[model samples]
Target chain A: MEEAKEGFEPKIIGFTCNWCTYAGADLAGTSRKKYPPNIRIIRLMCSGRLDPMFVLKVLLNGADGVFIGGCHPGECHYIKGNFYARRRIAALRTILKQFGLDDRVRSEWISASEGDKFARVMKEMAEDIKKLGPNPMRDKIL
Target chain B: MKGTELKQEDLEGLFKGLLDKKAVDCLVLPHKVGNNVAYMLVKDGDKIESPAASAIFAPSFGVNAANIVKGWTIPERVGIVAKPCEIRAAIELIKLKQMDKESVLLISADCSGAFTNQDYADHAGEIGDWVDSAKINELKGKGIAIREACAICENRLADVGDIIIERVDGGKVLVAGITDMGDEALSSTELSLEDKDVERQAEKEKIAADAKKEKEELPKMSSVEELEEFLRDCIACKNCRDMCPVCYCKECFFEQPLGKPVGGDLLNLAELRSAIGVPTNQLLYHLTRIYHVCTTCVGCGACEDACPKDIPLTRLYPLIAKKVQEIFEYVPGEDAEEPLPFITYEEEELEDKLR
Candidate 1:
């Protein structure tokens, strides 16, 4: 019943691979790119290490959205980490679709050199999540 | 392609011959225990008796026998007779390194569906007589139905087993060897083996098609609120995880210290959310479990049967598993050589699934 759409800032949990997205985020910050300061980044060695449970935990714990960033296909620093991550995130999204939360999570291939793309993705996700309103789980006692 | 047709009574002799000939050091099979039938490890040929050995063909299922045979590391070679689903679960376990494929022989049969444990125990006498006649259709006509999982089960025939027993028309049991080890074991028995074609594909397809239709007709949970509603009565006993044959973790993640919230953490969580469920993380527990098993789940419905609250879990897990499996074009327990979806991936695939 919270219909007030004035100045609602979505809280997003970003899981970024250290070799790619994490570096890209640092680059964005150094570049002073104007992206929403809504996301909290957790750097992992590889995207494959992002267990689906972690995303579920944060979402249920009241994070409004989740962002997953990894190396582009065939470009994982560990050879095939991003490939596995893609499969896992895809499967996770399929499960989330059943709960009407699929749109609340996003996965992208943002490399270390794509600071602009990384910042752009953050801004776009923040805007999209704002339009989606607060995550229903935010107020839920689940 | 060696097969032999024999009466139901002849099955006991064939199994006993395996023990007498030392084809197997032990036989893991279903036997009548007091009033209920349970899986037993029989070491001697004399221990294999009539009506008891026939319990394998009975429409009574208590647990997935794969759970019983998991982690068997003895030097003795064992032959395990089980339903098709149980065999499939065992195959998944073997692929997961939870069970050793070389250490045991997998014997599976054409399952004619099965009743839940309570139903089987209540009608054990009548069901026993019906099973002896090898007329499975008669039980349905008499208004005794199989469990929903069994009824919707498409993998009724064992395709991946080393040995397969087919119950054909006229109470005739046709035992065949599909693998090299299976042939060697069959050769030791006195029953003469000949080449025979098992033309059950059409029947199997029909059953699968019917099951698909039935599944499509069941109502689905489309949102988190609906899912929570469906699991409203769950007491968080974790029986479903315990009953699940593929949930083979030595220490489940939910049981770990990190998964448990202390009193202070609970208070903080309640304060943050303004309120919290008493059991706490009921949704998290089920979601994490379903996600964990989505890829490798055999859709055996053991979790549903284990639920004390009578939540229709079969409606959720198996259906979700079916969709997820379809996305990857992977069937759990179908092939040993196929890599697990989570462990292996292709460079250019599932593009539509990503943002």
Candidate 2:
């Protein structure tokens, strides 16, 4: 973890839905395609299951950026779950800003077969969050 | 109208008449108990009494009653006796697809006042199976019957009810229809409703002015620690959760099988710092609940009334909810078709990025 945290190296916590984004991530590994090492993935059944506090908790726990990838619209195994997740992420982004931690939070839609796009999105998000620097909550780390 | 007093018999007879005549399935009405008002279910408008013991209030009651009717094959048409706040809550719930208004009816009445749970207990001394409105009105002219939230509330007349049973004069009440269903329902009732346009206008104006003032004074904690201190006794009793109308999850995440309890039981510093399986983080629990139900919070103040520890959760939830809506422009329960705040986005949903 320390080696991965060298100067200007962003620690991105990615919450990917198992049905789509998670599968896409797995396929990326199987295909021998390399992506940024800074991205750490936690697979959830549905993006709708991701709670707003979980984002805050991750940021407060020291991640420089938090990325949420879910199934494309109307493609969720749990129909309309991605739609709900979309609204939740939009609301979460606003709350993050109120706490002055908005730049580090990002959300997008990805399908099960978009491994190449997933890699590119992660790389782009990591570069954007790197410009924002380390999370402020890191100072309070006990 | 002056305070002449409303009897239990009067309300019961009025509501029963509505149900007997196929006017409504249920009435979302408040019953007076020991000087406090409680919103409860009036089955077919019979056995009319205060549902103070039923901690859930209007906004939740509307959706709950709607769900109950939907489940039962009978009562294809149901009615909800609600307050203004409940009507607003029902609107949000309807928008969220949590409720179906097709089989439901709304019979809203003027809410004059009510009492907090603590105040009701203090007043209901010794003789207590449950108190009703007649005894409460007996203390009239002495200022003994008033809820803290009600006293501050300006939205006395509900704008959303199909039929509004308003206290018009000292000697009579007006059962008027604000909607087409209300008009049809009222047309069926034998009670006469004249066009009292002036009286209705005055009452509505007074309420609007009062609501403006009330909105200005919405309660909010100055800091994060202040909120933490206010919610100190939450302890995950789930009273607020149960009372809330919009928290409709069959099983909450906090109550999940894998979700272990955290905090409480250890005394040592190391154990205290690292206590596992303790139901701690009251703030996290509340924040999650607020996020889940923010769009649907109707500000009915039921959660605070139901809390055994008197956490003032009603005030806090609404405060946070207002902030969420302001930041996101997403009002829960307003329009069923409008996407939920967290579910959809606009071109400039992140307009604040510029700020």
Best by TM-score: 1
* Candidate 1 structure quality by residue, lDDT tens digits, B10-72: 888888998899888888898876556678889998988676435887777888888887777
lDDT (Cα, tens digit) per residue for candidate 2, span B1-355: 1111333235556567777887876655555543344445566555765332232221112122333322233435666766566665665665555556565566655554445555555554421322233544564445555443453454656455566655545434455676677767766656555564425677667755765566566565544345556876777788787767666667877676323343332234225344332454455567567777776666566677767887776466665566567656654544445665655554334434321
* Candidate 1 iRMSD, 1 decimal: 1.1
Give the TM-score comparing model 2 with the true structure, all chains together: 0.65
Model 2 achieves a DockQ score of 0.15
lDDT of 2 by residue, A21-111 (tens): 9998887778877878889999999998887778866775568888888887778889878767776776666545534566777777778
**For model 2, what is the alpha-carbon lDDT of residue B222?**
48
TM-scores, in order shown?
Answer: 0.92, 0.65
TM-score, chain A, candidate 2: 0.90
Error of model 1, residue A20, in angstroms: 1.1
DockQ scores of the candidates = 0.69, 0.15
The CA lDDT at B244 in model 2 is: 71
